[model samples]
Target: MAEPAPRGITSADLEAVPAPLVAEILDGVLETHPRPRHAMAAGELAGELIPPFAPPFARGRGGPGGWVFMIEPELHFGPQVVVPDLAGWRRGRLPAEPATPFVETPPDWACAILSPSKARLDRGPKRRIYAEAGVAHLWLLDPADGELEAFALTEGRWLLVGTVRRGEMVALAPYDAVPFPLDALFPLDAPAAPTET
Candidate 1:
């Protein structure tokens, strides 16, 4: 006989896991999704890149200024809960400080820095979830490739707005107040010099 599928997991099940562990819900099942080294580095790089242009609005790190720009914030949408690499909410949408641990208001913008382990899931289930939750803008950053893809929600579906390859400069929406360079998100270490044979 074939092995049985695992029981459907819920938000409560995820809550039972240790705080250090990261969990995401998909199709009513809970899954462990940890950030790899590059993924974490990419998120930090993004955290640095987004704040300067978003001044006057509170994004986390320096201070809770105006907007709620958070890294790996837990988002609850109906029965599904997700933690994107980064998420932000405009001050107008959330006037006061968020009183709850999990934000249900849905983010105005969300970024997912993809690693090999998560590229498929992020591009598929997570993308669909964000669209269903009505997230306005989505950014997919591939740290290894130094590529960025921006998407905007239109008519209840996600449409590719633009893409920035390595070493190129492009302004992404929801934060296009200034043009941002793609290479900033992924800094390359100096290549070792060739040995004299």
Candidate 2:
């Protein structure tokens, strides 16, 4: 007789995992990655955008203030759960903060900072999940090589919006209102540009 099929992972399995190891349910499988001690300029990117795009500041700081930003938010999309480095939702769409442990509503925009161990998941399964969830924008940033790629969901697929390299000023959507130097988000010794990895 043939062997029985394996059971799928569930939320309980994800929640039972120990701390310091970040976990997510990707395509029905429980996935975990080390929580880095440092965010490597990811925080800088948020610092630059939050003051202008998210509230308590925004319009007061001469920016289009209608966004709510989250860092490493556990987002649930049906049976799939994945966390992005940074995620944003338009204030109108998420007028009030969610009262639950995880956010079920998809973000308007999501960004991932490529990590050697997690790149495959970020570029593949996560991308498909985001597209399937109707996320409007996606950004992939490689700080080691200094590159940022912007993508927009179109016709149920992702369309390459643009790629801003180190030393270049970026005005990419959906927060294009404030143009900032891509170099500011990388260290002084970062490589020139980058190629898809």
Task: Tell me the tens digit of each residue's lDDT in model 2 across 1-197.
Answer: 11222266566777887787778777656777787533967798898899999988886778988899999999999888888999999999899889987899999999999978788889999999999999999999987667899999999999999998876877999989999888778654654553354
lDDT of 1 at 22: 72
**TM-scores for the candidates:** 0.80, 0.89
Q: What are the RMSD figures for all models against the true structure? A: 6.2, 4.6
lDDT of 1 by residue, 120-189 (tens): 7789989999999999999998877667899999999999999877657757777765565666565554
lDDT measured at residue 161 in model 2 versus the true structure, 0 to 100: 93
Q: List clash counts for every candidate, in order.
A: 4, 0
lDDT of each: 0.73, 0.85
